[model samples]
Target: MKVWFALILCWQLLAPAFANEAVPLADDPVVEQRLITIAEELRCLVCQNESLAGSRAELANDLRREVRSLITAGKSDAEIKEFLVSRYGDFVLYKPPVKPSTWLLWFGPLLLLLGAVWLLIRTIRQTQNNANTEVLDDTKRARAQALLQNTDLPK
Candidate 1:
């Protein structure tokens, strides 16, 4: 039992180190760091809301390898990004370029927010108008009161 407890504790302690290990990049620390930074700024096409560097998907791993190769080949960051953009289009970038092709992607949320606000305002106004229309006038209120007072007509 003591040996099993010790093994469990040891595994628990070492588990985090294994968890944090990413796909291996180039041996050069500088190039590896740059590659990681670039990869972290790219979205993984196979995973929603996960950066390429953070995603464990096979496609993300392939993209990381591609980035490492580009860095090893002495490609500047901009050149590497341009190459990726040319091949994959703007969707791979976490921060896609502001261009005609991407205007909807860039501005869609704001437009949706504005449209929702407009709809909410219109709904509220319509609800208020409906409430006003449904309210009983003075004559109707008096008639209702008379009906209540004449309750002897029905059980």
Candidate 2:
């Protein structure tokens, strides 16, 4: 009983060391809010689907720290954004400005979706047309009906 109790106590003491701890964020609410706003607008390079604010990746943490320093340095939001964009390119921004180079990113998925719809419609129509053309002739229809009805007529 004492051994079991000791083991249980050790497990309880050691469990937290293996668990994730929340990161320490900026102390001031305004600074924290600014960090969040900036982070939300930026995409995590390592987690392409998640915004930096929501990503748990190490790179995201580093980027947040960079943003915190920038805030502490009294840089305007636009200036901070510009510095990040210059360093990481437009891919870092969740909503990049529309430009000649970024036109594909803005419109490519819509074009692909429309193309898919057209192809689906065309395929469905072609299948219907083929089905219409495959109707059994009179003799074959008679044979099929006779077979269905269990007639013993020789083929």
Candidate 3:
């Protein structure tokens, strides 16, 4: 009975050894490689700022699996990307292609920066011009002198 109890304890300890290991992604490493390559080009919809290949989000996993199947079915990388783009729109592309609709997206910041720089230069030039043209007329100068001379504030 003591031997049986010891054997049962041993069996319990060894049971985890029988637990299934994580299955290899697929039967083909090439498929996994292609999946990673394609996924790297996609943005994770749920993660917003993360790439599908690097994100741990559930949606990212689903997209990876979808890519894997597309690869396995012999779709070229470009075709796989097009498929995703068709389904998810340009937002799924980390670097969206230039189009009439997206021209502002690509160049708007540069235009805004140029505008800000021009405004700053104009403001600085205006301030310097105002400072340089500080000739007070005689009457205004006399009034300024009178105010400076009268240091007492009204009670």
Q: All candidates' TM-scores? A: 0.72, 0.71, 0.71
Model 2: what TM-score?
0.71
lDDT of each: 0.88, 0.94, 0.87
Q: Quick one: best lDDT, which candidate?
A: 2
Model 1 gets an lDDT of 0.88
Report the C-alpha lDDT of model 3 over 17-122, residue by residue, as the tens digit: 9975543496898888778777788999998899998998778877888888888898999999999999999999989999997899899999999999999999
Candidate 2 vs candidate 3: the TM-score winner is 3
Error of 2 at 138 (Å): 4.4
Give the lDDT of residue 28 in candidate 1.
Answer: 94
Tens digits of lDDT, candidate 1, 1-155: 99999999999999998774656657899988998899888999899599988899988888889999999998999999999989988898999989999999999999999999999999999999998889787877877887989753322
| Clash count in backbone of candidate 3 | 0
Ranking by TM-score: 1, 3, 2
RMSD of each: 5.6, 4.0, 9.0
Q: Which residue pairs overlap in candidate 2's backbone?
A: none
What is candidate 2's CA lDDT for residue 112? 99
Worst 10 residues of 3 by lDDT: 146-155
Q: lDDT by residue for model 2 over 1-155, one digit each (tens)?
A: 99999999999999999987787888788999999999999999999999999999989999999999999999999999999999999999999999998999999999999999999999999999999899797889888888999997546
> Which residue pairs show collisions in model 1?
none
